[model samples]
Target: MRLQDLSAALSDLESNHRLRRRATLASPQGVDIVVDGQSYLSFASNDYLGLADHPALALALQQGVERWGAGSGASHLLTGHSEAHQRAEEALARFVGREAALLFGSGYAANLAVITSLVGRGDAVFADKLNHASLNDGCLLSRADFQRFRHNDMAHLEQLLAASAARTKLIAVDAVYSMDGDEAPLPALLALAERYDAWLYVDDAHGFGVLGGGRGAAAEHGLASERLIYMATLGKAAGLAGAFVAGEGLLTDWLVNRARTYIFSTAQPPALAAAVETSLRLIEEGDERRARLAQLAARCRERLDGTRFAGGASRTPIQPFIIGEDAHAIRLADSLRRQGYWVPAIRPPTVPENGARLRISLSASHEPAQLDALLDLMLQASG
Candidate 1:
């Protein structure tokens, strides 16, 4: 870990095309944006409902700053938690059909908080192989006996559950896989949780504000249980910053008192909380937006049906066209960027080795013609 060693590591990453870079965004997040001084029809955002730059949300943010100021001076346990945060938390809890909820700065921190506080060395945690990195890190850091099931494999999970002799057992999964865009078997997982007397933790970062009429993945599955602990991000389809973990009342009580991330971190700005309040109302009334998003995704899938970059089993907006090599995926993304489309190439360790892809992130703001034009250019490139 010396400076020279770090430099060597960086060089190794670049040589293998594993280096990462950030584009300079000159405009707000939406389909049409200026990244690195170029205007582009972009498909590189998670703003599924296209509300990131909504006038009302922007105005609400401004008003929030006027009412509360720039930052919360302390953590929630001190004086940082505001009336805005309280109201937002209450709304979030009700929206997700939970007895309570606790806000966090980001989904990563939320996952860590949930995992670490609930389990220790005497406990056990079973996770999906494809769960988000944060979840994996959380489990590793929890000092729990960590067991991983094959992706979406219930029998493996059951075997692990049946074999564990720990004081407590928890099952962790993503409601919708972030990269693949497929859903977990929540009903079956819940049945196993009930059968094994374990807790179920669901990270629904990519499903909220788009599924279940914006009530979230839990509602979409028509499932509920006191055993379920749910976390959804506000920054995705909700078009705001922060996350909230919701579940039975006592669960939140434990997090508030025991979760290190929440107890130690400064609260998100009051402006963000106010904007989230506005975003929640918008998400609840966003049926038209969701419909448009679904239509756009379906059309793109249809257009790519016979192409080399055919769609996978994803039903959500995250359509990944796996190119199998880092260099190839980067080249495809670069070619698209030159043509005024801004698709992103995703490579490891974000995905498995040799599974690099052009991640097509769709939004309700996208028009059919825009998508069609991109696909035509794509087909030309691949052809």
Candidate 2:
């Protein structure tokens, strides 16, 4: 509890190669950034559609700030929620085919609100083993009997569902695994949830604006919105801030009333909501960007497929090359940085032990020449 104890804990983390350090960004969130006064071709960001620095989105934010000022100044339940927020929530609900939607400060808080609000102590919550940390924390907060099925393994989920107490069970998963860049078997999971009369909650943070022609995983697979809860972050492919939870009216109403994260936190600035709305509109109409990005990702994977450093099977903008050890991953990332590419090292806790990797993220803004340069540097680094 003492500061000395905290320092000792930090030391322990560093010793175990689990300490996290911060990176300085001298540019806006986008395909390229300036760090330490040097420009780097960034492949470590989540701005998949490359709208983070989009001119239209910036204009919208500027106009919104002029109209709505800088802050919401309160929570939604208070006086914080503005007309911009309301319209953006409605727009997102319609985009995702949901009856209603509620905006949260971030995706992490939105997951916390949904799980804790829906599942109670006597209920059961089933989750994917490789789901985002927020969902894992949500289950912990629910105080319910938490169960994790094998990653993307529907059979294991079904088995767990069959043997569950048949109480109110909620199955939670990420539509696409963030670190692994693989999609969940959503159809199978939805079928099982229906058979067991359980609610299915999906966090599509990485899928929205990057999948389903930019509508996300549920739309990609033509799944309806009934008895299903979907949450997505705007900061990823949308290149904006905040998150939204979309579902039927009752589900959203319940969250508005009971979800502590939404009730207690200051609403995201109206300017951010406007910017996100703009980004969503562009994503819906920017099919060419999506296609180009997908093609680029596929090309990168194809070129790296047989290499010893490549860990293939990634179909999304996120690609990871395994290095087995933390030091090796760090070394490779450093080497890539020296070659002018800004790739980040993924270590344990973000990933599992011996699963350290270089998380290569692609953006629509990146050119073929950049990709070629990246590959050349990476191949040389591997050697």
Please provide TM-scores, in order, for all candidate models, with all chains considered together: 0.98, 0.97
The lDDT values for all models are: 0.91, 0.88
Residue pair clashes in candidate 1 = none
- Lowest-scoring 10 consecutive residues by lDDT in candidate 2? 305-314
Query: What is the overall TM-score of model 2 with all chains considered together?
Result: 0.97
lDDT score at residue 254, model 2, on the 0-100 scale = 91
lDDT of 2 by residue, 122-173 (tens): 9999999999999999999999999999888888898999999846999999
TM-score of 1: 0.98
Candidate 1 per-residue lDDT over residues 84-170, each given as its tens digit: 999989989988888898899999999999999999999999999999999999999999999999999999999999999989999
How many backbone clashes does every candidate have?
A: 0, 0
What's the CA error at residue 106 for candidate 2, in Å? Answer: 0.2
RMSD of 2: 1.3
Q: Candidate 1 at 72: error in angstroms?
A: 0.8
